[model samples]
Target: MTTEDERMARFARTPAGQRGYDAAEVDAFCERIAAAFQGSTMLTAAQIREHEFAAAAFGHHGYDRDQVDDYLDRACVDLEYARRGDSPHPGPERLSPRDVQRLRFSAPPPGRDGYAAAEVDTFLDVVAATLAHAGPTGLSSQDARAIDFCPAEPGGPSYYADEVDAFLDVVVRTLTEQEQKHTAS
Candidate 1:
């Protein structure tokens, strides 16, 4: 078995060998990643990130989807960092205020309680600065969840709460990753 094949084997198999991701599909994808890592293929990091996989469900056993996704993410990140000669230790991807503002969401209808759009915008502004190392707030998921939004004025729209919450999760992940890297150094 190849090294990639061996790595794939490390993941937990389906119970009693039931339906899972197709073995051939998994093998081909792994081969591509292996080739990229070994300088045999020109698979760009963006391609790695955007690549889609076919669902493998049949009488034969296959790999778990979650495990495959996790590994693929790690592999893509590895390739990106490798290409940039990055150590993923000291530097964090600086998210700009504009980037935060550009996060698209469907506004809630009038007369309904939504994530106060203004409050979320202000918080995102702060998050942008924090990510850029220009702010003091160590925002966490809990802190984000604690934030309350007021009802919108009559016929006024507010940001969707679930979308805002999902964005906050991304923010927290970015902040914690930066902090951990800094601390490790």
Candidate 2:
């Protein structure tokens, strides 16, 4: 028998022997298994069957499926250890007021169209309150800079300058018409 064949036969006899696989082949198999099981809560019966097929395909010639699976389970635990980055040692730190403000505004508004103007005002008020207690946290930087650079309101300082002005014009015209009708009657 060839060396690979002999190894396979030996693996079939041992409890944990994967028989025909080299270390690199075993590592590759472990990576594939990890990818397949990503985000899985628990393997289903169907998934177990699929894994059995995979084991058969990857196993050394004459190697039993159960032995391949047993090796695979240990390989998966090793793969998980590889996936989790090196554990950090405990370190010292100081909690600043800026950290508190960061915690406060970290959650953005939810939903498709985002917050309405009223909701934005409420959020700004909360942020302002947080800054007041904690000191200036650069909360209104964007609005303050924009106001300093471009101070004009939406209608360019005229009541009848734009769509909002046009809408107001229409409202006034409708009220005048109603008043004229009342006078005529």
Give the winner by TM-score. 1
Model 1 agreement with the true structure over 57-107: per-residue lDDT tens digits: 656556776777656655644555455554432212454455564455557
Alpha-carbon RMSD of each model: 9.6, 27.8
Per-model TM-score versus the true fold: 0.46, 0.21
Off by over 4 Å in 2: 1-10, 13-50, 54-61, 86-185
What lDDT tens digits, residue by residue, belong to model 2 across residues 26-87? 44444454443453244322232234332323443434544555444333322233334322
Global lDDT of each model?
Answer: 0.58, 0.32
Worst 10 residues of 2 by lDDT: 86-95
Model 1 spans with C-alpha error above 4 angstroms:
1-9, 16-18, 88-137, 141-185
State the local distance difference test value for candidate 1: 0.58
